[model samples]
Target: MTMPAFALDYLPLGAPDFSKIKETDYLPAFEKAIKQNREEVNKIVANKAKPTFENTVLAYEKSGVELDRVSNVFFALVSAHKTPVIAETEKKVMPMLTELQNEISFNKELFKKVKYVYDHQLKKLKGEDKRLTEELYKSFVRSGALLSDEKMERMKQINLRIADLQQEWGTLLPNATNNSVIWVNSKEELAGLSEADIAQCKKDAESRGGYTPYAIVIVNTTQQAILSSLDNRNLRRRVYEASRHRADGTRQFNTFPLVVEIAKLRAEMGELMGYNNYASYSLEKTMAKNSDNVYNFLKQLIAEYTPKAQAETKAIEDYAKKQMGTDFKLQPYDRFYYSAKMKQEMLNISDDEVKPYFNIDSVIVNGVFYAAHRVYGLNFVQRTDIPTYHPDMKVYEVHDKDGKLLALFYSDPYRRPTKRGGAWMSAFAKQSGLRQQLPIIYNVTNYAKAPEGQPTLITWDEVTTLFHEFGHALHGMLSNCKYNTLSGTAVARDFVEMPSQFNETFASIPEIFDHYAKHAVTGEPMPADLKEKMLKSISFQQAYALGENLAATCLDLAWHHLSSKEIPTANEAANFEVEALKKIGLYDEQVPPRYSTSYFNHVWGGGYAAGYYSYLWTDVLACNVAEAFQKFGVLKPETGNAFRQKVLSRGNTKDQMEMFTDFTGMKTPDSSGFLKYRGL
Candidate 1:
């Protein structure tokens, strides 16, 4: 297969044959791009001109365009469309890529050029250019440019193992999702589920040869959708056990051993870098600043949430007994179902009541896209010209009010057997001044596919999810940066979730709710009563929601905090997690960590790793940001524009804290905003 001049595999890679390449084009392109990078590096080293900002640092930044353009496609496919071929290709390429990174990090000539420009350019530059230079120099030092050759070799091996294990970690989950679900035959077994759920299950079972009478698929989250329903405690226990243990006890995909090795290796690498643990090493460049800050920040939230979560669980137990007429203890599997039932009885609302208003098209056009237009004066016109990863993916050309092209947005909105679970955003092309390239961004979600001929009715959670992801799209789309490494949504992990999570607020805002929350059949807006109940009910589930998240964060911290001199085995980490939770009064077998280490792709798959607590970290940032909006007003153009210019547009070209300060005039967001939001 020949590649297109700028193949659909990735955004146009320049105007030439770089744009049009086939899978067959990969090895050649990889060779060509790496060779081209080498030549570019050589030119920078050999240039007769003095190492000025323009000649040394800027030129070096621009030099890797070919290499970057090709790898984006290569890696995205490996993550999103993995198959035997892609998997094998990934294994083959991993060592080569890892070595390439090491080579550049250690290159003496390149460092000299970079150092010369940085030392001399600080006084000559302003804003991002100054920040970029500082960042690059700091990066070089941190990446071990000054290390002895032997230590560098050790560092290389540790990093190489990380890359491979991370890949293995990410690869195991999709099939685990496939293998973990149960099949059922009796309608009585489906007692707690809605008619729609039952219909969906029967349809699902029918598709699987009706060979079995009913099928219930367990999604990749700790809380199975079936847990909130399905009357039988036995069934709930079975599903819960399977989900909690999906990656444990199974040698085929078990990540227990991998976790221990990765943690130990990360600690060893960090010790090599003169840091105590991986957390300190990783957070050095991030807004969190140090492991102490991360610990204190999360500990504060835990202190507030622990009491409230306990109360909420107790409340649920009381409700379960009252409603079910049994002393059946409240379990993790029952939390969603009874809480859902209790929500309806107490607040007169359930997800079902809110589902109609957020059918797929309404949510996209009136909710997610509508808010974008209102805030950014952007418009989305769907186009079929773009190639997509899957058929459901919708592409659009976004333009400013002045009709200039702003960015390209693509959304993949349905779940699939092949797709690794969870919602996230990825860049096909990053916006950068060096390359003059606009961001081509994709929002991938795992919402249930709409039944045949049924509009994609979605719950409020799903609606917020769409908004959450598009927040990331806008961050990428709006970025104005000079370096690809510092481009949109490429900031520290703790800060990356700020924008996307911020957007979730809009999904519930009256301005947005009025526009998108409409019944598909009647095309009528959600009734004020129901919408009010929705606002009153689900959002208050904060205790339940935030608890699950906090438990997961605890689980992550426990895994990564292993001492570098000696690391715990997988079983030890698991035991350590239980103890961590117990110390915080969170040791509930019913409520496991949202993901067991054995199958947590977020930490292992991409860049998240021990950084999963970032969601909590940024929730604090975002919650405080919302306070900024409240003080001004949600619709203030001046404040929104300030946020855009300071945070979203600037990317990581500047230090992350500077971006926050520029917008909020604060050195940091306080922890109070998060606790207050959680109603703790």
Candidate 2:
């Protein structure tokens, strides 16, 4: 059988021939890759000699190379450029991949060989070798290797069903979001938005065949960014309601039923594994260690956040009442608009004033890349010869200060109908010294594109997001690990966000900020007073930011913490979410969760399931690291190198906390940094 072009290795590591690859190639490529992987595994199982660290552990680690390569490209496209064909391909391919995983996990002979090395030879191994042995053993146990025959069979079925449900939820939620666009017949309804914004809405409507003259597309989050600028109260309500109910059973593409089923199945899997709930099973290897610890940490923060949030809401309400008569009442849609208005009035800063300085290209080159060069001695040279999956993507060759080719970086920085909302960092190939593979890292964002021939200006929040995603890229690009399994951003969910969040601190630093925050038209730096106002207002809306996030995190926990019997029906999903928020003291009508249950793709579809609190958990770690950088001078190369060595490059080879202590000189990460950073 001839290997598909997509499945073959590229001459330059990690660069796929994207121009030749088609949606039709994915299924065949996956089938061949899986077969190749199974054969490699079979070789290890058939070895007659006694298992050793090299033969058993390393062989298993190296076995699925082709499959991983195919999967990396396939899934990246599915998320970043999902057309109808790609979506259909995902529905067919996911089950086959899941079954392959189960086969590897449940192979009694393979497990015996891996266990033999883990039990007898692990003590002799050192550093990454030992860590790999331990991780491999634990992975087998987590995959039901120790279960009875009946339970193992049942686990296989559960895994298959869960995979299907996750794919369904992932597909349904994004379609629902796209379909929920609010089409306004006239520009009068869009009076509050800027001319550029209004133009973009018109363009969106025209792109969708002009169902209406203007269209407001719903983003992935429960709170849409447009809410902050919209003037008409009724339009704001319409947009907010569209976002809030996008994936409810009432919608054409519903995910409520899928959410309930996934939760119940996860609960059953947890029970089979002898855990109280899915959260317990999931958190066992994370830094938080257990659900109780996560709950306690959230509880501590909630006690402080609730009062601050109440005061914040009261202030916004007071402002709203003054603006519109005394009888005016605040609603969820009013929060962003009033918050922005109050900030503009109080601090004399607005997104409109800040956006001109944040032209998308300048932010990428002069801002994000500049900081990388200053701290990490890295440089990016754009490559036009490389083929990309989309025209919006730009490829760059990343070079170290020593002039050696380090990695390939790709950037996709615009919103499209097919692209999902929010931003993320992923790789077509992860760094591995053993495989001699260089990382091919890409960052995908959903910032609205500018009109033809117009310069793209992004919000300050989006600028921070750009920097945040690059932090994850750096983690992958600078990885020094030998094994692919432990390389790059493959750390604990609770710890992985630390790198990304810590990177955000760089976006506001004066040295870097001045370079990138130039007016798109004039190329002039922002005026000193304007810069001061913008910097001063960084902590302006901490209550809403923290409140929405905590509500979502708590909502994630509420679903996963339930036993099988406690799982709600599809009809009760909304009520369950309301009660969950109320129980956690996060039930504010004016400040909903960053994601509601029905449209909470992060929990349901994204791998976050019970792990959404990781953003808060790692924010603490990130702030602590940020404080350390401040102590050492934020742009100091010495501090950056130390972090790259201690954290980013280390990957999962060392203990996560130990890596933190090694760099920060603190045994425990300080929670005070989080409070100080958020201005609570």
Candidate 3:
């Protein structure tokens, strides 16, 4: 029998041909690509000529092109339009990829050549070439290139197992989320929900293959957005429980075992690599430098924010008691609901009132793209000719200020049963000067779909999310790098988020806000007083919001801080999480961690193991960067070009902090700016 031909061979300007690709083609394609990549590596190893920078480091960088093409499309599909077949393909392909990685990382000959280039060729290489050589050498060392054979073999096993666990958790969690939807038997149970919300709930029930009156679909987070508006305490509790327990031991879809195994493997790997714990190993590559720095940073945040969060909780509790009488006690589900009411009471504003002004289309066109044009002088034209993975996805051709084509931007804007939860940006083809490649970047979001014939109106949070994810898109699309390895978003986890968070601040800019924030029905701009209240209301929940993030960050560190022997069993994970939160003094029954251990995908399934602190870490960097923009004027082209040249286009070619200092002309990043921005 012959394997089916795949469309991976030839891409139109490096853009994937998603239309011709089939699920069965994936495994064979990966097998072929891996073979080619191995042969490429072998050439470097076998060459009799003494290894030069071109023959070794540069050659290694250029190898795996075929593998990257297939893997990029395959993984992007698994993320954006998942099926059981894709999951199975992922399981098989991930281990193969892991084996390839281990082979290269552990290969003595390859490491020898790379080390030779690093040691003797410093004067010949310039700029990115020098940085790439240094980064590659460090990568080899960090990946156990210097380890003994026995330890290297153990490290390979750890890598393969970690890959398998990531695949399992990724597959299980989304299915668990779908199964955890709260089914309602009647309409009254959904009281306080708008007509659109009710209709969406009905549609959700229909999609679940039920004749039920309503269904409240669960997102990947512990807190449900719908909880803020739900008046029925019993129903709110049900929804909250569903979210909190989606991956907990309450169901067959439990990820507790995977979490434990993953942590244990990482701890052991860290020790084998000469670190105390996984956090130490992971932090060595990040801007934080070490675990102590991360701990101190998080500890300071907990101390400063805990009191403010407690005070805010008391204020909300007082207001809730006034409404429900002396017996009223606040639960986790009641926070969003009463806080929203409190916002209304204090500022005469609520999410529902502000949502009408945030039409999704306008937000993308005028708000997101408008800001892009202001900052980067990029233009977008819809590209219907290019085929997308899903019909909901929109393709646009991006052009630079001088009318040269820059990149392709894909946007998948609505939620479906097949798509995963959360919003993120990914690259199908990362920009590289060596390959003469232009980026094909896409942003995936999980906003609730508007009903047929109804416009998709979004909340302000969603509006900021649009700007945020596009911020990531810009990072990828605008990349001008010599090597794919040093391309956009390939920086340290702690530093990678700075660009996106900086972009998020643009959503509230008065000029940019005016361009997009208009009534969906009336096309009228938001009233002056209402707009002010809406913007002010954004900071109202800052304490609770930041505290939850800090707690989750602390929880991530706690899990990763363990030694191999100290890893908890699956049964002990819950108690472990409780104790972890208590240790950090962030344990609040009314305000749970944003993500519990079992469902903390960032550490277990995603790439953020021991790195979830990147959010808070980069939040400070983002606030400081935003402050720099204020000095030169936020929308000035000179300021924009300087940022683009210094930070955006440099990729990982320079030190992360040096890049910030380049733009800010500062000796160090300031946490005071972050505090002022957060109103702390």
- Candidate RMSDs in order: 2.9, 1.7, 2.3
Cα-lDDT of candidate 1: 0.76
Question: lDDT by residue for model 2 over 1-680, one digit each (tens)?
Answer: 11233474453545877877777888888989989998999999999999998899999998888898899999998889999999999988999999999999999999999999988998899999999999999999999999999999999999999999998877777888888989999999898799999999999899888999999998868888899999999999999999888888465687888989999999999999999899999999899999889998999899988888999999999999998999999998999999999999999899999999999999999999999999999999999989898999999999999999999999999989778888999998899988888889999999889988989999988999999999999999999899999999999999999999999999989999999999999999999999999998888868888989999999999999999999999889899999999988889998899999988878888889889999999999998998899888788899999999999999999999999999999998778657768877
Off by over 4 Å in 3: 1-11
- Regions more than 4 Å wrong, model 1: 1-22, 48-50, 202-211
lDDT of each: 0.76, 0.91, 0.88
Which of 1 and 2 is the better model by lDDT?
2
For 1-680, candidate 3 gives per-residue lDDT tens digits of 11113436445666766677677888998999899999999999999889898889999998888788788888898888888798888878888899999999999999999999999997789999999999999999999999999999999999988888888888888888888988999999999999889999999999998768799999867888899898899999999998999888555888898889999999999999998899889899999999889888888878788778889899999999999998998888999999988988899988889888998988999899999999889999998877777888889899999999999999998988878788899998888888788888999999988987778888888998999999889889888998899998789899889899999999999999999999989999999999999888888868877877888898999989899999999999999999999987989987788888988878887889999999999999998889899998899998888888888888899999999999998877778656658866
- Candidate 3 deviation (Cα RMSD): 2.3
The estimated TM-scores of all candidates read 0.94, 0.98, 0.98
Give the worst 10-residue stretch by lDDT in candidate 2.
1-10
Clashes of each: 13, 0, 0
